[model samples]
Target: MNRSETFMEPENFVTFELVVHGFLVLIIGTIGIIGNIFCLLVLCRPSMRNSINCLFIGLAFIDILLILSAFVMFSLPAFQVYVERKFMWNVIDVYQYTTPFVYPIAMITQTASVYMTLTIALERYLVVCLPLKSRSICTYGRAKRCVFTVIIFSTSYNVTRFLEYSFETFVIDEERGITVTFLQSTDLRENPLYISIYINWLYMVFMCLVPFSVLFLVNLRIAWGIRQARMERSRISSSQRNEESLAIMLMVIVFIFIACNTPAMISNIMETFQIQAVKLTQISNLLIVFNSSISIFIYTTFSRKFRRILLQVWHRKRPEDDVLFRWKAEGGPNLTGNRSTRTISARRGARVLTATTSLEFQREISS
Candidate 1:
């Protein structure tokens, strides 16, 4: 095919792939990478560390990997048309050399991210809908284990992706000394049984069907649980209210996941039926990138604790400030002790009261 007929053909000097998956992804992915990094930093803090946040930390880290891989696989190639021939040649050389590994890494991270999000949903369901059992079931150690297990499963499931492509180097024009390398598919990648079972059926089942179904159901239960909790707002403790808020935040995340992932799932179904959906697939890829990029915003908007901790990290505030902020925001200290401890508690409360009154006075003056 001529350049004009090629899929990467430019429209007004910019290709569709370049515009959608390349330049757009470059901008969004950069923001996502930075946002996920901030998420990691905020989630790691003492105040934010918990079972749910641990899973969030894993999700954020996987997102960073996925975004970086997307940049290399999709975004970098978009810039080839804008660079000098020599630079483009080097870019192609680097891309070719790294594609085999990058492709598998991207797949692995993407799958891990999907499962990680699922894990978060399941964890939230247990906590919010099955609160009585969640006390025993959900713990920091268990969350870490779940994260590790998902990583292992995602990696093991995608192991064949590593063998799917083999790198080949050859001279395109010996006279002009132009040499290039490209990834060539292996026999295993072409096998009908492998393609049908692993690539088509299993991918649809595990990556799309199962996660989406479970997320939908779990989110419904979570939403219902939050509704029930709101009815008894007067009886619920501040901590319980915080947990409910976290659950609400997670529901929003799952909602976004479903919305962004629906196109990709539909595209997969079309491809499974031997239908050509190139445009749909491109749109799906864009949405997937977008989905991976927006979790930080959801957390910021829906979880007050996340916002507070994020601000604390950004401002380099003391840990005590976090406690005081929580106490102030929640309307009291979430303290637990026996009657024998009232003396010491009252002394600490007096100090806290004095400090809080002084801070409130300063705030009133500033306003």
Candidate 2:
């Protein structure tokens, strides 16, 4: 759907794809909005307002916008196609109203989000392993600078994409029957210029393997540092345990990010090799929505704070599963029904205790 070959395949275009994407846009948009809003709340808290947390929170907001943009354009159109509702013309109108630019704003958003995530990982490694240096350097002022830099640099990527690709408008007249239009796509769609012979190598070197190597090394060093501290101390302080949990959580987050995005990246590389006709390009577009959607689960589902905020959002009104999760996270010392469990409450109480001294007393009583 995004290539520049100037070939038309209406037969290959499945209208049902529009329906699937419509659902996708709504679902992903909801996830992005809910998750990012929670992240923003957490980041705004004075205690949580640090460089690493700021980075992740900023990423969530970006994802929200990206998902929204996708919803406005791809998903809605796909859904319209499925319903045969002719609603895409309205979506195109919304697209014009909402989009900052006419060309691939989504591509830009995802690219920026990826680099921002890498920055977040780097900041996390620093904060966990080099607490002193991180304290000195990772201030609000420094974090703001990093965020600004990421925004500016990521925006520049769109320049190349727009310069390389453009769009066309088509009209279908009654006398002429049907008229078609062609649109040129982004520069990332092209083979590397100076290194065309080594397209895969260049992409792997600059975009994939190099960054992966650095992130893996940083993660390893942080893991090793945490282990050494544990061995030397023999007894872990609450602070030490906090550091370990954070490091582990952050590490898993980065690993999951890489895992979720790897298949799509490989698919992009394959595009440069075998220009196989786009079988399910719309499906791929929907996958992009899925890609952005899963970040919510990756960041929020595993953490106590995320659950707390989410529960707070639904305060005193929830279904069975949410009630279960809330019970599990809150140390419901006196859960009323099937939600009750000593082990579950103990674990949640420990979390609450770690977070608050008042809760610490509560946990002891519950125990």
Candidate 3:
């Protein structure tokens, strides 16, 4: 199908799609931008700086870029088409030409995001499975280097996509005198066999399958490590426990990534096989965007320290509230439970003082 037809298809350009993709997508993209910014703000704090937080900060930055790209490339254009009867072909042309360049950027960000996740997983694995070495390997400096390396390699790998697409003018309707310029694949999309093999097999396997498998297995290993440590009564320090929690938080994000991207991959495979799954493809794209948008929420849900600190920084709570928050955090009295070590310590101290005073008085009388 041609770009015009694909964009303005009766099924594709229905009111529902206009409302969803045009309006709702912009909202989601905006929220994602803000959410990721908040993540950066929270994760970049001196107290929050760690190897995993470094990876998370990188992921958040990439997600922000991805959301911005989606807004410019997809959501804004769709909104323009929905609102303007006389759509500017020039704008669309620029969009078309911009896509090949943007395509590589998006892939670079996405691939880097995936690799960062893998890096986090590996860091977690080392921390849990090989605690002694983890301290040496999972330093913030090392994490920064890994993130830099991932970005460099991913960008290098996908830069070829920019050259693989170029714009060509195609006549949409001779009677109506409509000619539109749209992006066309140079050789890969033109050749059926090449497109099928590259997209269906190679791209799917490397991009989706390998990453998904690695994430799943690594998370399973983390879970097993946690269980084994508990069973063996191994002394996991507070920092190690925090690392495990962070891994669990990232595991949820990775699961969302798999869930969101799998449908898109499936649709790509079906399209390669000449199967009709346009709706599935559209829905999958939305889900992928959503996946990119919701990581901050997942972090908030899993990390109490994140939530507390975020609330403190964002809302600027009162000093009393801060004291209360710290008390609760330190296992003092809380709303859900009332057993407080502070109260126990206070009572124990008083009893000890009374017993010492009585013993001293009795010793003085006997002497």
lDDT of each: 0.76, 0.59, 0.69
> Tens digits of per-residue lDDT for model 3 on 54-131?
888888888888777766566665665654444544444445656777766766776777777778788878978898
TM-score of every model?
A: 0.81, 0.67, 0.75
Choose the strongest candidate by TM-score: 1
- In candidate 2, clashing pairs total 5
Q: Model 2 over residues 225-340: C-alpha lDDT tens digits? A: 87878788878765556567667776786676666566555655666576554444455555656656675566454456555545555564332344445444566454554554
Quote the lDDT for 165 in model 2. 47
The best-first sequence of candidates by TM-score reads: 1, 3, 2
- Candidate 1: list runs displaced more than 4 Å: 1-14, 81-94, 170-180, 231-234, 321-367
Candidate RMSDs in Å, in order, are 7.4, 9.4, 11.2
Error of 3 at 348 (Å): 21
- TM-score computed on alpha carbons, candidate 3: 0.75
